[model samples]
Target chain A: MNFAQPVYYPKADYIETDTGNKVSRRATIAGPQNIILGGKTIISSTAIIRGDLRRTGPGHAVVISLGKYCLISEGCILRPPYKTYRGNFNYYPMKIGDHVHIGANTVVEAAMIGNYVEIGKNCIIGKFTMIKDCAKIADNTVIPPNTVVPALVLFSGSPGQFVENLPESTQELFESQTKQYYNRFQPLEG
Target chain B: MAPIKDRFTIHSKAVVCQDVDLRGEITIGSGTVVHPKATIFAITGPIVIGANCIIEEAVIIINRKKEVMRIGDENLFEIGCRVECPSIGDFNTISTRARVHYTLRLTSYCVIGAGCLVVLPEEEVLEEHTVIYGPASERRVWSGRGHIQELDLRRKHSEYLRETLPKFNRLRRGDGA
Candidate 1:
């Protein structure tokens, strides 16, 4: 929480037009100065993005960057992984690709998340973990640090074991469904 | 001192941010950092916190209808976690958004996973180095010590917050350099 006491936001909420990004006022985004978002993204209430934890050394490093058509649900924390290098512990940058939907209460500290991925609720994606494109992580999945998840595979359980291959229609389905959600995420027009 | 005013006493070397909502007798231990917007309400009795603990933002720690609440040293209460536990042992990692309710005694080196709902029964007793996690509520007991690396991360985070957060929020007392 910042120093400024949060006032009452509009009941209906806010949405960006050009990028089509919808961010809830209740979301705690630390260092909004460093975050970059692509078009048509939805960040729900209670989502936390820790951009304040940046690299140790100087130079303007991008903390977190998201691609188009992403949805971050409630109580999710998006933070970069930290590691000690040359006697200095630094937090590297984190990048996410397009059409990703991260479900509620998920703690993500991954280095890179690929496109068309869907992560379910209450999952923990550990630091420096790289997720390839079109993966589906089931609910309560725990992917350990430095782990790599391949594309188009369904994964579950602790330590995130692969379960099954996704359907052929997965890409089309996610694209269309996320578009629908973005269109339907209105706060009830007055 | 009046009874209502005597309940709130902040000890030395405790850094509580100006934005915190504290009600009743809450004793903050030395080297502990309570971040901004952390709401801690003591309804039953006094709440005592040990040293070197970090309480992050939006964390609601309430002692409702209970006798006393005591938190241990070197513990990390992550963001958005709702805790109503009575006695918490040292070095426990209560992760993000995890709800711990009515815990009698949590042994040391226990790692409660993120988003886990831990409601301990009166008869249940948590062993040391117990990792409680998953939506299915799996319990994994270990004989060895806890993850010192994970605890170290919190210290690093607290150090970072100590350097950075005061630039944004108004800090109350002595904490980090």
Candidate 2:
């Protein structure tokens, strides 16, 4: 199979959201097709979410997995590997959780992010940095490699620190924001 | 020292680069080296830097309105000096291990030693290598904060602030416009 042809949005059977918005896909990478969509997940145009572009083996292609109700903003880059053997490279099998809003131009190499997380724009979440659930990270904050963020906290800065706990007033805001994002891109049913 | 009346103008050949965001009305002089990974943000006022100065790595120069970060020529912010207040004077050599948090208006040919957290609001004179600190913490052994906490706070804070802040149209220099 020629892998040079750019992959297009699934044409035959894609559940459409009630908002009449099909997940827009433009200028994507080539690899093994491994996509997982649950509830309402909208992948925006000009967003690159896929696995590596190298040869894995027979019966194995690249694997790009998106969880249920994950909204990756425009210009976001998510690179997951197609096979487990190629997982030795740092940022393969990128895992994102439910009710997450990744801002524009944010580069996430995170293997996993807990639910209810809000990341700001121009931020770079480096490899192996696990941000726990209900954590709100401020914009331009760089989470360096091998950093562990505890749950329900607010992190900001170049190196990032636990400035304070998530205030009670902002908890509802965080929860509702995640729900709104997920609701906006819920996949349409057949 | 006393507060000045006007903004300091800089030459246009200032070297500002690498992961930096220069904001608000600020003037950077020619031959000034604002090194890689440095940030200069002026939200409420203007930032003025003089000619022939060197602002080293990871330095943060911020000024509130009515209190701008006014830096002088040939002075050096050597590696990680965070001057949040104005009143830093000319020919001052702020070492790598120093963090000046308060307003300090010094004359030319002075030195702020490394690992010093000098908070003197009044004018003072220091010989080269003289470490200064708060009067209450005088004679205390100076140690650095090791890691910066405000960078993350600033990153998180900039998110909320930028949403409502006035967007300054970066003048496209005819190359990418």
> What level of docking quality does candidate 1 show?
acceptable
lDDT of each: 0.79, 0.56
Q: Write the per-residue lDDT of candidate 1 for residues A16-47, one digit (tens) a residue.
A: 55767888878878777778899899888878
Candidate number with greatest TM-score: 1
lDDT of 2: 0.56
**Residue-wise lDDT of candidate 2 within B30-144, one digit each (tens)?**
6665544456767677888877676644567777556656777667675456776565556566644356654555445455544456676674544333334321324332232
Error of 2 at B163 (Å): 44
Q: What is the lDDT of residue B158 in candidate 1?
A: 64
- Collision count of model 1: 1
In candidate 2 chain B, where is summed lDDT lowest over 10 consecutive residues?
B168-177
